[model samples]
Target: MSTSPVTLLTEDDSWEFLRTQSVGRLATAVGGEAEIFPVSFAAGDGVVYFRTRPGTKLVELTVNSRVAFEADEWGEDVATSVVVKGTARILETDAELAAARGTGLVSFQNDDKNVWVSITPTEVSGRRIARG
Candidate 1:
């Protein structure tokens, strides 16, 4: 085993890590139960955007806006994880939809994405473990 130490990531570093990832897990609560789903996203600034078909995922967000999102990267000798606590909102306006379309956010599965959800993170934290 590699003797590595875990270190807290700086805020800037955390955001940088998030921007580098296109796939992440979005965590939401449904009927008091936490559910997580993998989503393809586009990250920039302080917001993370994902495209999803109108279904349970959209309904779940309407039921509860609070959510947690995470993405990670792993290497032979180092690993990093970033978590985001945020609120999910559906983009309703035409401008919002158009803007999202411009980002080229895609869903993992082949489905018609009628709705785009924007997660404005309230808090972001990350950690990195690297070989000492």
Candidate 2:
């Protein structure tokens, strides 16, 4: 069976695709190496918010704020992906944290104190592929 290749996505389509998912891969680079981690996120007011533990990964991200976040959907013969290029910043203020919490995306079911990270997208793109 032949597989279809990825397609270039438009800005509006990319944003719309992202709105359909609540989790995506967050890609970052440090020491010339790249890393991509799956993260649960919420989008609001043109910002993406997620919670992570405070540690080395967080430190590395702070030092290199530029990142790419992606979310996608797949079916038997079709797939769609959305990618967002942006800068990430730690939300330190109580107000900022509270606002994120208010989004109701964060689960209080867990005991971990959530540390919020916000990604402001500078570029967003998406693609859809189908096989007949």
TM-scores for every predicted model: 0.88, 0.82
What's the number of clashes in each of the models? 0, 1
Candidate 2, residues 1-132, lDDT tens digits: the string is 866576777776676676668878899999898998878877766777888887766977878999999888899988998888999998989988887776567432454746789889998878888866
Task: Give per-residue CA lDDT, model 1, range 103-129, as digits (tens).
Answer: 777567768876788999899999999
Segments in model 1 whose C-alpha atoms lie over 4 Å from true places: 1-4
Stretch of 10 with least lDDT, candidate 1:
101-110
Candidate 2 deviant stretches above 4 angstroms: 1-9, 107-113
Candidate 1 achieves a global lDDT of: 0.88
The collision pairs in model 2 are: 9-126
